[model samples]
Target: MKHCRTRLLTACLGLSALTAPAFAQQACAPRYPPPTTIAAMFDMAAVTADTLDALPDVDVVLAARGGQDLSKYGLRHSHLAFLVRNDQGSWDVVHLLNRCKTDHSDLYREGLVNLVGESSITTDLRVGVPTPAVRGALKALLAGAAPQARALHEPRYSMLAYPGSTEYQNSNQWILEVTAAAMAQSGDGTVLDDRKRTLDWLKQRGYTPSRMHIGIGKRLGARFFADNVAVTDHPASERISGNYSVVTVESVFDFLHRSGALERELSIPHQTPVPAVTGTASPRQASSP
Candidate 1:
């Protein structure tokens, strides 16, 4: 009777021990919070951008010391400039202007998609040989091919522009003149040589030379805008306006390729690794140290 009682007790203990972890896990397992809505995401980006803009210029520099905080402000305007992951495990942007909204869906298709009509910086250069891996990844994105682990070897591109006005004409002309001067200073031979190459490239692509415009915007304050609106026949024009630090697409690709974001994106697998179980004794450890 004593032996049977002891065995029964031992069995009960074992059963409890076996079931405890399952129970504990059920109690402790994380309940993922509700997914953020598209509107909420856009609001966050706007707040972030506004806060960034409001900070002292020096403070902005400090906050962005090594990474994207600075770049984000420079590259993005009211549009959803940064990327966020959704509950369904996809990356998306929340464009504030409803630029990406379509009748078919409220949530825009995310990841490696392109702006309608024009090729992004990555797609435009991918067909050429001796292309960098980052460039290839960007190309893959523009082509809707796949996400790459590597950073793209290309400068970022944006289609946004300030509203047009003839009042800012002088400011616009100044922007072009500055661009030409910079191109002249940076070229291997003469500014004319580089201009010829650029013009030829544009011509080969069937771009109308007369439609090219370079100008500064009064609305943008001191910034300059360079655009190729004629190529696409867009009435508002496609322009990029910023300080001299901003490089042309060719320069941007060369720099990004050298920086290794492209290679990293390509080589790294998408799935993050599950952490190894820590502090648990293995079967062998249960027997000995």
Candidate 2:
């Protein structure tokens, strides 16, 4: 769901391809969010924090945001991450972020506020509380067994990476793989050693990916112009038809729900301030000590 399409398809492919590299080496320009937007985002972050704080029985949960307009796909949230309860009792976000305009990605650990930064489309936050056993395992995986957790990420990134392939990975795909590995951990401490095993574990659990139908025109455009979208890693049969079984936030959430991995789901709405009356104090001022 990382928007890495910095360059659009120009008039002449030959000239543009030759002059401009396939990928942009530098990160995309920072967006200057309006003050009001920033305030709203902070408000959403605060509400999200409060919601997570209320989940006393959960140590790790899935957090998602509406980063993109995915209504066409019947999806709400466009990105997903794990919120692990830190020693300080605050939650921290762990997720994969693709290097801007590149076919590469890296794991990032940030605070809840950063995860909800500059809200797009919507400021509503989705949280999935895992079953107690699953939560404990995930907490252990991301904390005590962090190296093993980090090893699960495949650096090569693709927007529509196949759910069953290790050639490339999308952000949500990484979470699925890691969750498989976490679930595969045995009481004896044995764990799935690699991505292949994790994928197999997911298959055994009946994990289903979201099937997206990309038209030929859009497929061609992505293939030729987008570095973060690839078809080579996908099954030829599926690729040729322009339908891809890719991992998405909704797909992963459905899988977890079906597998009895998630015990609860909730959405925290963005708390916007009420309009101030002509001579009244703002909400912030009224709430102040």
Candidate topping TM-score = 2
TM-score of candidate 1 against the unseen true structure: 0.19
Per-residue CA lDDT of model 2 for 135-244, tens digit only, reads 87888888853777777788899989998888998989888877777666733355975788788888977999999999999999998999999979888989889888
Which candidate number has the best lDDT? 2
Q: Lowest summed lDDT over 10 consecutive residues: which window, candidate 2?
A: 1-10
Compute each candidate's TM-score over C-alphas.
Answer: 0.19, 0.81
Q: All models: lDDT?
A: 0.25, 0.73
Runs with alpha carbons beyond 4 Å of true place in candidate 1: 1-85, 94-245, 264-289
Encode model 1's per-residue lDDT on 1-289: one tens digit a residue.
5334433433332223324221011222322222332222222223322332333321101000011122333321111212323343222321111222111111123221211111121111121111233232222232222222111111111222221211111111212222232233333333322323433432343322112233455324323333311112124334343222222222322332443222221111111223444697779989994
Candidate 1 differs from the real structure by a C-alpha RMSD in angstroms, to one decimal, of 22.7
